[model samples]
Target: MIILRTPRLTAHLAVAALFGSSLLLASCADADTTSNTSSVSSSASDSPTSPVSDSSAEGTGAGNGGTDSGASMLPSGSSSSADEAGQGVGGNASETEEAPKTSDEAVSEAVNRVNRDYPNKFGGWVFKGDTNFDSAADLTYAKVEQAQQGNAQYETLLIFFHKGEYLGIDSTYPQQVVSTAPSSRGLEVVYKDWEALRDSGDANAAAGKYTSTVTYYWDGAQVQHEGRIPNTGL
Candidate 1:
C-alpha cells in the first residue's frame, strides 16, 4: 500500500505496509506539516499554478497516488558500503558541488515563490514567508498547517523543487520526518540504512516520517529531473 510521508510522523504510519519504494517529502518543522508513496514523479509542467490545499487530492495534493517513484533509502548493497547512499539514478554531481552562492535577495525571492506557488492543502498551515536555506540552505522556509500543531485538518505532502526552490518552514519543534533534499553537499553515508524495519524501510513516509526530496536544474523556467532521482525522499 502507498502512504504519505509526514513530519513528526509516528512509527505506526512510517512502518505501514511497504509496497514499491521511494521518498515522499514531508512538512519540515521549520514550517510544520506532512505523505507516503510507493513512487513519485513530478516535472515543471506538473508544477502548481495556483494555491492548493493539503486536503485536496489534486495535482499538488499529498494524497496523490501517481505511482511514480523517487530515490530509494539506500542504493543496492548500501549496507556493505556506505558510499552508495546518495548515488541514486541520475544523481547530479554539480548540484553537490560548490557554487558562487545565493544572495539574501535571492533567498527572499525563493520564499516569495513558495508562498505564491507552494502547496498548502494541509490544515492550520499558512504561508509565513520564509526560507530555511541559509545562504544556500537546502530548503526555503514557509509555515504550513498541521494537526500535530493543533491545526484543524491534516494531510501529507511532497515538495519537488531545486536546491533554492525548497523552503524549510519552521524547525522550532519536532514532527514526523524532517524535510531532506538530495545529498547535494556530498555528505558521507557512513551508516546509511532503511528508516523502517526489515524490508519496510523502503516504503513511503507520508503518513509517518518525512518523505519526498525534490532537486532539479533551473534555467529561468525549464524544470527537469532528468538523470536525477524521482521527486520524493527523506
Candidate 2:
C-alpha cells in the first residue's frame, strides 16, 4: 500500500492536506481500476471464443465407420464370389433353354415305344411291321417233276415279280392242296418273300376249296430253305 504525507500540523493546513490526500487516493484508485479493466479487455480480445469443431472428421467418413472413400462395404471376396455364382446360374439356364430336341433322339425313343397302331391292314406288305425283314436279292423257285400226292401231282409253274424292294411269288393250285408236302420235308429257307406269303394266306382263305385244277398267285416270294441262317451278325 502507498500513502501520501505532508509536514504542516495547523488545522487549516491539515484540512488542505487531507483534501489533497483524498483526491490523490481517488486518482490512484481510478487508475488501478482502469488498469484492471484494460487487462481484462486485452485478455478477452486475445482469447476470443474459439470453439474447435470435429466436422471435418465427420465428413471424412469417420462418423459412420472411419472407412476410406469409395471403398466396398461387403466382406473380402464376397463380391467376386457372388458374380461367379450368378454367371454359373445364367449358363445353366441358357443351356436348358437353348438346347433343342433332335430327330435322332426322338427316333431312339420311338424305336423303344410299342406301336399299338401297326399294320392297319390284315394281309399286306407293311413297312416296319410286327414281322419285318430287309434284304436285297431276287428269289425264284423251279417246278418239281413227277411229285404226286393225294391224287395230285406237285408240278406247277412259278412266276417272279420285282415289286420295287420286295419279290412277289405267283403260283396256282388247281387241285386239292395238301397241308404239308410229305415228300418235301426239311426244306431250306434260303430266301424269304413275306409279301407273297401274306397275300397267299388271304387268297387261300377267300378260295374255300380247290375242287378242280386251279391257279394260285402270291404277291411275295417262295420258301427256298427252312431255317437257313446266313451272316446273322450283319
Error of 2 at 135 (Å): 92
lDDT of 1: 0.31
lDDT of candidate 1 over 45-133, digit per residue (tens) = 45444332222111222111123232321111101111112333455322233353464554445345444553343433332332244
lDDT for each candidate structure: 0.31, 0.28
Clashes of 1: 62
- After superposing candidate 2, which stretches have Cα over 4 Å from the reference? 1-10, 49-234
* Best of the candidates, TM-score: 1
lDDT (C-alpha) at residue 206 in model 1: 28
Q: Which 10-residue window in model 2 sums to the lowest lDDT?
A: 72-81
